[model samples]
Target: MEGLTVKRAYHQHCGLAAAMDVLGERWTLLLVRELLLGPRRYSELLADLPGLGTNLLADRLRFLVARGVVRQCGVGSAQRYAYELTDTGHGLRPVLLELTRWGLFRPELSTVDTVRPRWAFLAVEALAAGRHAEVDEDYEFRVDGEVFHLSVRAGRAHGGLGPAQPPSVVATTDAGTLLVVCAQPTALTEATHAGRLELTGTDSAVRRCTALLTPS
Candidate 1:
């Protein structure tokens, strides 16, 4: 707890209050959301989280590291530093997914809101729970020119920012069409037939992936 902050404690002597003592700060949970996919370099996190000032980002990262929620690790051959969640941090996955599900019922995005193709991974993870979670498969998605991949194994989903090598299934679509599919999975077929989505793979793999995305 080297960099722990003394400010902003709820002091209510409750478990939830204690948890919030570390996470209640602004941008903390969103920062955790960014790391939910995997480790990200400082530049990557900054780029992904718009309008989070550098100084504040640095402060929040320090606090998280001190609290054992994140650890600094070297990346690639250059040994550049990247931030990744620790076991305690990974425990927040369910919390994040629940929040994602809850937020899905909110109002649609306005013109001022920003969107990233990678966020589609969160939707998939949230919606796929208990629906084919036991299936092990690799699925690639190409949305709005960016590539992402998801792997499911042992009732868990792991996602990354790039393609899945030798992917079992590949689904390509624009952002709007992808949103529609995530909201109404049955529309996937119609979207494919209408040229809004292009699904490529063997019949079985495609079927498995479709079932995985479709809610039970």
Candidate 2:
């Protein structure tokens, strides 16, 4: 109620409608998507989301904060402000994953479309579909010079914006190669063999990750 804008209220009693009332606005869900991995500073959010006007970003952040979906907190010793998802905001993870799964079949990439390494984390989660349920492992990925990590625990995947400590597996590849592997998991072996994707770790850890990435 705190962040509800009366002017745009759907005035609907249904739960889905209520959710859409808050999230259906233009660029709002994308904002949530960007925050999925972890907390981000204002500048970081702006950089990741190109073309979203600064004023609109500010307004949306304010709305989300007031709605209790996100909160602002001190980040690092500098104490600069960063925005993070609250428990209520994390409740949208399933929704985002579902949307990602649905979008995967929509169409091929367009020339103007942009892809970021961090997004691959969410895409992997969507693609995995709980295949990592029995897995408790840490995977570090280096995509196009960017580094990120994924940790699977208790049947869910969690990602962060940087390297993992003592990762179980380390995967190095570019965005295109990663995309290809995700689309045709069988290509994982080929990609590794061809040196398009590099995987490193103990044989057992690497095999486990390879299986997770290339599910039957």
Candidate 3:
């Protein structure tokens, strides 16, 4: 429990207060964000989340597990354990998506020039959710040097870290390019021609896939 910050409960019979009792702790909801994609090892979580101390991350995981929001399970041939969100934990997706949208679009908020590749993965999902489009395809996005897989199906988006089935389209670009492209409509051909984005697949497929990453 080293580095854990214990806050006094509101001691009131209110749903908001009760939620705070569970999720109000620093980095708790951010942990929910990481788990939304799927299960992850303690080491994987620590590596992806910058600025979070090891002790603090472990304490937060324990707290979420005790609250029934996260569960630990065995993974890989090594028989190591990983943490995944419970159903109740997965239900927080929409809440997290809304928050992401607000953070991205709110004019009053300062713009973020740099972002983690995994965070970009979630940003695409949030934008896809807001699109409400009827499309289904698996896309492999190579941002900077990191690879991310994004799938949009039945008007919803789902994805996680690593490669997946051969993608319908593959886009190679940096996080900044993505943010600019999402904010303003940039032709895929132009981006590709400029050498800022390397695109592969049929022109039509590339176009459709690119739409998935654009902000709504």
Candidate 4:
């Protein structure tokens, strides 16, 4: 019997290999996904990745920080830490967006879940402002029966409860219709005519929100 020869799997110290080493795990990528949208405290991360255990989460975060993919920063009274991506971390944006575009294409599923792709959210926000300006203001998106509130400050976003303030604009549509609008160049009016989109609220605001969210 011939013995099998295993190739030496060595990744360069300062390349994509190094980058993958930092964010290649299942939960690790999602952690980056969350941060790319904005900063989040430990508990917020837990909520985002409910599948992660405390020990594993801590270890993964430690690995990211050591690789310069993420930075831990100070917060308020509880001294909660928020994580933001470094320059290297920002480079992963394209990769995430590609995956999201792929995910939206599941043929078997009848509709999108409206979970809000982190990369899409981040990309839209980036188009509106520079990296450091993401967390400077709060935002909210409502659809169907749910509302997602973003509490941003200093260019990071937190998903906790937000204050009482009217949204800059409101876009009302079902998850599936919104997904189509965001994935393609289709117009909202057309979607509505096709019986695919039912919406009301501020038309301008909705369009503004959709403009940033849809990749193409």
Which numbered prediction scores highest in TM-score against the true structure?
2
Work out the TM-score per prediction: 0.84, 0.85, 0.81, 0.57
Q: Write the per-residue lDDT of candidate 4 for residues 1-216, one digit (tens) a residue.
A: 123222233377777775555556668788888876557788888776766898778777877777688898877788777888888887787676556555544332254333443433443334333223433344564545555554445754343233215555444455555565555555555766886555344666555444445444
lDDT for each candidate structure = 0.81, 0.81, 0.77, 0.58
Candidate 3, run of 10 with poorest lDDT: 105-114
Summing lDDT over every window of 10 consecutive residues in candidate 1, give the lowest-scoring window. Answer: 101-110
Reference-based TM-score, model 3: 0.81
Q: Is candidate 2 or candidate 3 better by lDDT?
A: 2
Ranking by TM-score: 2, 1, 3, 4
lDDT by residue (tens digit), candidate 2, 106-143: 22345787778766666666766556468888999999
Checking candidate 2 for backbone clashes, the offending pairs are: none
Model 3 misplaced stretches (Cα beyond 4 Å): 1-6, 12-14, 106-114, 183-193
For every model shown, the clashing-pair count is 0, 0, 0, 4
- C-alpha RMSD for every candidate: 2.7, 2.7, 3.5, 8.3
Query: What are the per-residue Cα lDDT tens digits for candidate 3 across 134-169?
Result: 887888888889888877888887777777588988
Model 1 lDDT at residue 2: 56
